[model samples]
Target: MIEEIPSEPVVITHIIHETPSIRTFEFSRRFEAQAGQFCMVWVPGVDEIPMAFSAGNAITVQKVGEATGALFSLTEGDVIGIKGPLGNGFSPEGRVLAVAGGVGAAPLRPLVTYGQADTFILGARTAEELLYAGELAGKAEDLRIATDDGTRGHHGFVTALLEEADPASYDTICVCGPEMMMKAVLGILDAHGVADRGQFSLHRYMKCGVGICGSCCFDSSGLRVCRDGPVFTGDVLLRSSEFGRYSRDAAGRRIPF
Candidate 1:
């Protein structure tokens, strides 16, 4: 079972507006989390949502639905329940390529901090959605940004920029994003014959992040997302048909990806 951290209500000390819909909330105290560890956040009467831990006990929240909406509605002094630093995290070294899509940059940011050196590629639907540009600049050896629209950087998916990059220069690649985006990244690496050098972070609906309810388990393999991962090696992901193909909802029903 995964352990929950803080063990008490945590107060929000500060907040940074990353985008109109995304915000990074800093807790009153540091959580000592790792590169890819996540926290189960409980918001009073609202729902509990899992979020990747950012720097200094912070968690970036993107207002995507009711749960996030409720979380975002809180004021600076508001308190929330936090449970985690759960699951495995990245241990990247040497020349690294850190890839992020949309709010997926939240988790990768900590990974970059841990690595201390990396080339970061951040993407979003528009330039406005691109996050942590300056923060990443201080940590990344090189930083690239992309948007689907012509709003910023490359006028296409970040993967397009990645293709133009000399992937052979990096010892490893760490990626987190929408399933489709991750799939595309995997494909590009495969085509370039560097598939083995990638690590992918995946998301699925969760009820109990401690691996008790078995809600985050994958089909066929019995691998629990809350326990076995949220992050997986390129080899494990490549071999799993479900990697980019399917997921379960809150009801544990198979849903095509």
Candidate 2:
């Protein structure tokens, strides 16, 4: 039987800086989360943001804005609220190549930790900005790295690295990153005729983690991202016009594309 877990406010106990602009928050939760699932983290006085789980069963947050910045300022036992292990995550059932760009590495970490038939390709703009390299390198079968400034392993975009790889060697590909990067990867997958077999995590600015808010809705299928996915198959991704576009926040104001 599937046990239903209730969402509630919890206290944050720790914070770690994964990079200059990125930090990870450690929060206590009893619920078990799948690899790519995310949670809506609520700051008492600020807005709640959807963050992906990095460590299993723990909420790891990267400092990006007001809520996240407030989260980073918190100390041990600081009170915070959380709502879910929301959205679909990566399911690496076959030979998989997991690709992560910038902070995108966080959500994909769990799959690398527990799932099988996986390899990892991690990228950042610089060596200092690269997160989870050591951990992913240890867990993944084959690990590759790329940076925009030539400060790390390969000097180029991760998509360039993907283009050079043999797509047939892997049964599936999992990707998460900036919209442009994911879109570029998707294009490469298409040219290689492997688009149908890949999975992508769509990063969007979300207000309510639940479907009712409609803050994360995409017009193409009228799909609510919070309810339908933060993760989708490449074929499904291709069908959504909103994949590369910006979405609205709770205020119904346009963010940016």
Candidate 3:
């Protein structure tokens, strides 16, 4: 078996400005990882946050929180630490329908690039926020876009586009986005009787990327997002008490959505 790598410092090789708010950081040391698995990114003195791979040695970050703000201030040659390509990833098989919202598109990018997905629907607040449309258009057999501001192909939620499509037609449906969005997608897929075909990626407060800490644990299920998943099947999510309803804070306190 290959030796498991531990947390180690890495230098940023380059950065790509995907959008005004989103950036992709490429590291000097390359590693192997599946699409949906995540790494614990340590920002030196700031904090450590879990980030999913956009590539083998790269992470796509959206400037949203304090940890990410610190990440945004760094430039090429800056140092950070990474631990694990931990948690189960999507094992997409056969024809796939991929749906993503906002920065959630980053993780699903690999699936399309590998020719696993036939259709991709990307939703954002506006046209400018739509991530990787040009790159994905050429990769996916059918690429669709939806924006809340009517600035793109479909002027509504991504869920609306999903409803229009044949959910049962695809062998697998992969999704990652805001918890509310994924929850809505699950409901739709359930209505179509294809809930079992869906796979969803979820994010929760994570202190340990190795599942030692219970910070990322799903309510009642005792499933740890850092280990058991960042990706879960539709059936598992449907049964989760905390799936879309609420999430834990840094203190492990439940915060309702």
Point to the candidate with the largest lDDT.
Answer: 3
Can you give the lDDT of residue 249 in candidate 1? 84
Candidate 1 residue-wise lDDT, 192-256, digit = tens = 88888887878889987778889888766778888888888777777786878899888878899
Cα lDDT tens digits, model 3, 35-140, are 8888999998999999988888899999998999999999999999988788888889878999999999988988876788889999999998888878887778
Q: Please report, as a residue range, the 10-residue window in candidate 3 with the lowest summed lDDT.
A: 1-10
lDDT of 2 by residue, 173-230 (tens): 8888888889888888888888887888877667666776677877688777777888
Q: Which stretches of candidate 2 lie over 4 Å from their true place?
A: 1-6, 253-256
Give candidate 3 regions above 4 Å deviation.
1-5
Q: Candidate 1 — which residues are off by over 4 angstroms?
A: 1-6
For candidate 2, the per-residue lDDT at 1 reads 31
TM-score of 3: 0.96
Clash list (residue pairs), candidate 3: none
lDDT of 2 at 164: 67
The per-prediction CA RMSD against the true structure, in angstroms, equals: 1.7, 2.5, 1.9
lDDT values of the candidates? 0.83, 0.78, 0.89
Deviation in Å, model 2, residue 6 alpha carbon: 4.5
lDDT of 1: 0.83
